[model samples]
Target: MNDEKFLKGKVALITGAGSGFGREMAKCFASKGADLVINDINMEGLEETRDIILKDHKVEIFLAKADISNSEEVNNMAKKVSEKFDNVFLLVNNAGIDSGLYASLKSKEDSYDKVMAVNVKGAWNVTKAFFRQMKRQRQFEPIRGKIINIASCAGTENGINPFFGVYSASKATLIAFTKLWALELGPSDITVNAISPGVFLTPLYKNDPKVIRLLLEARGVKLPIDKIGEAKWVADIALFLASPTANYITGQNLILDGGMTISINKL
Candidate 1:
């Protein structure tokens, strides 16, 4: 609703923008006057997200239903984005999925591949595609670009999470990629960072029945956040990281766990 233009005249490409953090980030960026290219595999969800943002924010938005795991589709999405925006100032690799609870002994190859494809490989493809634009900008423009990746606290801690081992590992891989890319892009004035969210109640989580059971059984109860983290929190952080305000920061992971990770010892 805030029409103040921090990102005026900028362009952003966000993956997995159909729901949760991605959807919220799209709205936030639109509110700040940024044109958006939102990608997701969920066509219905993508349409709803597009409609919502289009209502209040008149910024140009393009939505595509592409699975990030498919390299060809991903590359095509990147091409479409580039054609629409010419150059992207903000690239957010935020599409991911939960593989449910699988024990180490019960982990299947399909499970590993599915999780890795979206969480790790998907991030890589998007980053690589956008980096080409960043590199190109390095020669002509100011090259002040940002890459914000979404990670999770599970990457750093292992507790009673069921079937989340693969998911955690995928997030850890993304964090690692963020660090390495930050190093590679910093000299060009491009910033790369990651965000690790705790328990945020979103459609992405609520839709997974098995994940809800795992949470209830593992912790026995939910924390007292009243409501889980809103998608807006993640969006706000993304805006900060992409803005000139965070120009000096790069290769850092901001854990937005809402005290959950901090209270692990007491629990």
Candidate 2:
């Protein structure tokens, strides 16, 4: 961890902090001396994340348990934020669900609705909840708050991805929110962006290393990047976007697939 502590006096709210990108980003933000408001539907997972951070970093960690897909729960979390912090310096909407491999026609309507509820509508609710605090800070302080949406490459490209219809559609909707919200929040000095990751070796891949490699090879993803897309890489991009260097960058989806998307398109 860097000793500079660039975000020494800031507050970052990361949804889905129970695992995956949310966990990685929360750790990174805390290492930079930022207080954390971590949310997840699973209380146990959120506790694990909080414990992990507390062991290494001394920053304050608030466990916000809420189902982001539930608008009432999301609004309550926002109220909790108001009662605790004056402003939210960074909001990362990482609480999204994947519908695995399924064709649109074959998949049930409930599956589609569930995915949309978490990935698109859920993110909207969280962003709207935090936008007030971020905007209010802009009025009295020079807070250039940032919003990061964790979308997916399957959702980004125009080309069709086999068996990922509902999941892709949900993520595509999130990317759409990133662009539109960035525009709406720009004048208030809040930047909105997204990270579209493909082929990431997330915890979702529950298998041995060799077995995972064989699975990837069977699927034809023999990329030379060793690890195609690591969660840390996505976390790093989030940090950079939240930094002063990205003051002018907004409404853009930074693709973090390590050329998988490009090569597929070219080939």
Candidate 3:
């Protein structure tokens, strides 16, 4: 556990913060004394998340409701955030959607369109909207900032499953973007990375226990850690990346699948 107030006065922007990983990351960062700019399509959930955090942590919470899939909305959101905070030092692209279970080969065009719009283009939109702002912050600090893309193990063989082909491809593209953007942004001292997490009982899974069991079995029979993941597990890794300790780490995809990918690679 990190000591208190290590991230005091820092500003973090997290998208898809209504629940699950986004909410958990918000809480974790708040606990460390980071003011937040949280976004979600669900205003009620976002408000609730803000209230939950304010009760315990004295951190500023700025809520923005916008669809990340739309570039215009994301640009407007960037402008809105600029009014509250000078710059967003930490950005977590946590908003993504999965296109239900089906053979991706026969999946409808609409399905792919929606998934890519949110999972791939949505991330691109948010990053593009704030790239210059993050880069400009370099004038004050050697390290401009950190951009954490919430990719998935599904993008790799580690967590790939029978019906997640579309989501996997989208996440793979996200990983590629991470590498390319990191290379471009390196000159400005801005770090870009991806965290590929495995099976977790997020709201998507909690909504359907059967789906969780199916996903777990599809990923693997057993993981080295022999347990399911929680949002905090990924949040802890995000916390490390957001901190100055990760100043030298960029353009990398950190896997947090409890060795599930390694086990899969063995077979």
Candidate 4:
């Protein structure tokens, strides 16, 4: 465990923080002593996350219930964050949706739109609203900001999975933006990166061993670790990117696929 309070005075804004990676990151950041601005469309989940964090950490946690897909809502939430904190040092665009197991021909257009709206445009909306503050902070801070976008292994051309073309494309878009923003923001000392995780035992998997086994067997997939990933694993990477440790890294997509992506047979 990192006992160093590296982010003691910094403020972090994380979207889709109600559960999964977002929730896990919130807990980790708070443990590192960073104040939090957590957002989610689901109020119950948001409150649950807040409760979990408050149990062990005393950092300030502000909850915002907003849909990241809605530009107006995102802007409004960002306004609240700006009002509460003078500057946001970290931004995590972790809110994303997956279009469940439907063939390309059978998938609904609305499904595609929903996935794109939250996964792609949602990330854009949050980043644009908070970037201004990050740029302004550069005038006085050594490192202005850090942005971590939660992408997926499915986004890579060679990492594509069956029946998830829309979700994959949406994540690919985010990956592109991660690199583009790193280029555009690097001059100002704002590092941007993406974490592309493969199979994780998140709520999506329901934490059922039978379901996981069935899915892996059905897809003929094999992982070197021989198990699904944990949300904490991804959160740990986000912490590294947001910390001063990754000062020189930028515009990179860090794949967390448990060696699945490197397998020729899986590819």
Tell me the whole-model lDDT of each prediction, alpha carbons only.
Answer: 0.81, 0.84, 0.87, 0.88
Q: Please give the lDDT score for candidate 3.
A: 0.87
Ranking by lDDT: 4, 3, 2, 1
What's the distance in Å from true for residue 229, model 3?
Answer: 0.4
Candidate 2: C-alpha lDDT: 0.84
* Tens-digit lDDT string for candidate 3 (73-142): 9999999998878867889999999888776787899999999999999999999988888888854486
User: Which regions in candidate 1 have their CA more than 4 angstroms from the true location?
Assistant: 1-3, 138-143, 157-163, 207-217, 220-227
Q: Which ten residues in a row have the lowest lDDT in candidate 1?
A: 155-164
Runs off by more than 4 Å, candidate 4: 1-3, 264-267
| Alpha-carbon runs more than 4 Å astray in model 3 | 1-3, 157-162, 207-210, 218-220
Write model 2 residue lDDT over 174-248, tens digit each, in one string. Answer: 899999999999899889999998766666555246645765565566554666567888899899887777778
1-267, model 1: which lDDT tens digit per residue?
233786777888899999889999999899899998889999888899999999998888888779898889988988887777766788999999977767645778988899999999999988887787876665334546889999887775632254467887888889899999999998888889998887776886875656654674576544435345777898988888877667788999998876665556566
Count of clashing residue pairs in every prediction:
3, 0, 0, 0
lDDT of 4 by residue, 83-139 (tens): 899768999999988898776567799998899999999999999999889988854
Model 4 scores what on Cα lDDT? 0.88
Query: By TM-score, highest first, what's the ranking?
Result: 4, 3, 2, 1
User: Candidate 2: worst 10 consecutive residues by lDDT?
Assistant: 203-212
In candidate 2 the C-alpha lDDT for residue 267 amounts to: 43
Candidate with the larger TM-score of 1 and 3: 3
